[model samples]
Target: MQRLQAFKYELMPNGEQQRNMRRFAGACRFVFNKALALQKDRQAQGEKKLSYAAICKALVEWKQQAQTLWLNETPSQALQQSLKDLDRAYSNFFAKRAAFPRFKKKGQRNSFRYPQGCKIDQANSRLFLPKLGWLRYRNSREVLGEIKQITVSHHAGKWFVSIQTEREVAQPVPQGGIVGIDMGIARFATLSDGSFIAPANSFKRHQAGLRKAQQALSRKTKFSNNWKKAKARVQRLHARISNVRKDFLHQATTAISQNHAIVCIEDLKVRNMSKSAAGSAEQPGRNVRAKAGLNKAILDQSWFEFRRQLSYKLAWQGGHLIAVPPRNTSRTCPCCDHVSADNRRTQARFECVACGLDENADVVGAINVLRAGHARLACEVNAEVMASAAGTHRGDLAA
Candidate 1:
């Protein structure tokens, strides 16, 4: 099957190239913001919003109006690609495929993506752009498939290039056994076969430095050079946290996918589950002032991203990903179908009232997820059989 994938490589750029890239990214951001503001104003005034064609025209006019704006760091196709992205984002939003466009704030944006021509080669780790010369890259992994598009962005004060590719991935059924997974903030993930992946709070480990960087950023005056530097420090720290989380997810997902023919997991609404209530004025969840800090830690778990990756990776490997409904999977006893919130007294302990079976809460959830998956499979089989019989009867009547 054909799949779209990306290969990201760190860029080795001199000061000049780095500055140029920054300028290009800034220009793109400026155009997007300007267009969005204009669009909003037009809406308020009851005028038709400017389409991308109109925006592209404005960009051409602006580029011609002042060479100084784009002189140091303008790619020929970059601005055009940016306009396309704005259009696409709005299109997706209007189609209800994505959330509405949010204004891009300074220092919060990290990436920009644009289209590429056919001259790019993933094997050689080289790309030829309109004005930019044949740029060589230091690739960390082998670029897996055909290059579709390329995006160059800065993260952690470093520039990197990502090549989107399309390739045919062979999905062969595995010989391994089936397993079910239950994901939670307390224990990351628990498998049906009794194996568990513990939550390694990478954010917690790096919170001290992150807090220091954030505080330093907050103290600096807005729009000042010092503030920019401090903001970069904060960005770098966040990038580190993201990298750590991604690495952990990749490792866990690979281990689970490789060992299982069928993987079942709870379809949890993580956003709803991550909320913590307010306590008395004396004591909050962690510290009253640190409410946002604690919340960030919970959000950083990236449970949703984990499930997304597991779904596709397992599909690509010819394994199944069964997302059972988020019923009382934690409290329901897989052995006897009993469900009660009281069954779970602590984060670690689970005692079933119906069956008297005791197990880890996460393990119980995993077992329940597996049972749900099995039940779903059986129901699907029966449905198929009924459909077949119905079709046969209809054919006989027609005859």
Candidate 2:
């Protein structure tokens, strides 16, 4: 089996190299924004949007032009990559996978990719790119597999390189254990086997400090040195919180994926669940503030990230992940199959009115999810068997 993975490391660039990188990133951003503007103008003028090839042709002209000759200083490949990214963004928009491409902003997620001509010197912890050569990085882990592409990004005033590689590995054999997971704000995840993972609430833990930093930033004059410093502080804090949440999710997902051959979880619609409760002007929403706080808490849990991590990791481990409908999972009784709004007496407790079986609400939810997953798997097996039998019967008839 072949797998693709990315290894990221913090880059240590000299002053000249750092300046070049910043310029390259800026040039890429400029190209993307300029191309988007051109596309919009052409659309307004009743002309078809420029294709990637056309944009590249225009880019070559722009680099040679007297006014925009500075574009020539950056690597031509990086500029072409920016055009490719814009094209992809447009494609995604047309496919309804994402919103329309927007103009790139300065100092926000500055990055440029090197599709080819990237070399790694692991022994010396150095990386070489097309134009920027011999950049040192902190080799936290060994880079595995054949390198395909490299992306350099600036985040929280730090530069990093991400190397994507493809490698062949033996497919893992299923370990034959199945578990269902119930995710919530109180506990991160509750398993059908009665084990639970606690919520880290990383954002909540750092919320106060972040709030203070933002307040200080607001007090500083706009575009002042102090304001810039304050903004950096807030960005660093946000980055720290994100790192903590990601680390916690990865650890939990790895454990769950490794332990279970089949993992079932609720198909949660997080966007709808976290939408603001504020209503139209004529019809005011009640408990708007309470709903807002609940939305924050729900987002803070990072349920989607947990599920995403579990899915890919499970696939890599030769396990299966099933998403069952979330409807009535908490209300349904696992022992008696009784489902009622009143069955969930509180957030943490569940009691069936039909058979009077009581259990933890999350645990009951996990059990119901497991049952649903089993039913789905059984149906799939039955269908496959039926298809095979039908094929054999058809063969006999032909004979």
Candidate 3:
């Protein structure tokens, strides 16, 4: 089997390299915003959206133009990749996987990618990109596999490089028993085995400090040295919060994936769950503040990211992930096949009406989820058997 991984390192670029990187990142941002604007204009005019080839030609024209010829200073592939990114954004929007594409803002997630013109000298802890000579980096760990591409990003007053690589390895035999998980606000995750993982609450933990830093930033004059310094402080705090949350999620997912041969989770629509309750002017919303806080807590959990990590990690671990319907998972009773909203009178408690079985609501949800997963697998197996009797090949019903 082949596995792909990304190894990140902090780049130690010289002043000239830093300036060039900033310029290149700015040029890519400009190209992305320009293409997005073009698409928007075409949409307004009821015309067809621009194709990648058309956008590339437009990029060439922009480089040839006197006013924006500075774009030529950046690597052409990077500029093309910017266009590709915009293209993908539009595709995602149309496919309903994401919101509509938006214009890029300067200094927000400043980054660039090199599809082929990148060289890595691991022995010397140096990397080379087109138009940027070899630069040293902090070698945290040895990167493995064949390098596929490189991405340069700036955040928290530091630049980092992400190297995506691929390699072949023997198929892994899955270990451990199957488990079902219930994700929630009160508890991060409750497993069918009666154990639960706690929420990191990274943003909540840093909320007070962040508020202070933001207040300090607001006191400084806009664009002044003091203001820039304050802004950097706030940025660093935000980065720290993100890093903490990511670290927590990684550890939690890794543990679960390594120990479970099959993991079942609800198919949560996080975007819908976290949507703002603020309605438009004429129509007001009730409990807007409460909904906003709930939204924040849900976002803080990073449920979608957790599911994504579990998916790939489980596959690589030779395990399976099953996403069952989320309806009534919390309200359904694990005993006596009872289901009722009254069964969950409180957030933490559950009591079945039929057989009077009582337990923690989350644990009950996890148990019901596991039972649902088993029922689903049973249906699939029954179909496979029926199909076989009908002289057809229906393989890997649980896959």
In order, what lDDT does every prediction score? 0.79, 0.93, 0.93
Q: Summing lDDT over every window of 10 consecutive residues in candidate 2, give the lowest-scoring window.
A: 171-180
Clashes (backbone N, CA, C under 3 Å), per candidate, total 0, 0, 0
Off by over 4 Å in 1: 66-73, 118-125, 218-229, 276-297, 388-399
Indicate the worst ten consecutive residues by lDDT in candidate 3.
390-399
How well does model 2 score by local distance difference test? 0.93
lDDT of 2 at 359: 87
User: Relative to the unseen true structure, what is the Cα RMSD of model 2?
Assistant: 1.3
Clashing pairs in 1: none
Clashing pairs in 3: none
Name the best candidate (by TM-score): 2
TM-score ranking from best candidate downward: 2, 3, 1
- Summarize candidate 1's per-residue lDDT along 261-367 as a digit string, tens digits: 78888887877756665666887555545665556666768889899988877877778888889788888887788779988988889998777888888888888
Residue 386 lDDT in candidate 1: 100
Q: All candidates: CA RMSD in angstroms?
A: 3.6, 1.3, 3.4
Error of model 1, residue 69, in angstroms: 7.0
lDDT of 3 by residue, 142-234 (tens): 999999989999999999999999999899999998899999999999999999999999999999999999999999999999999999999
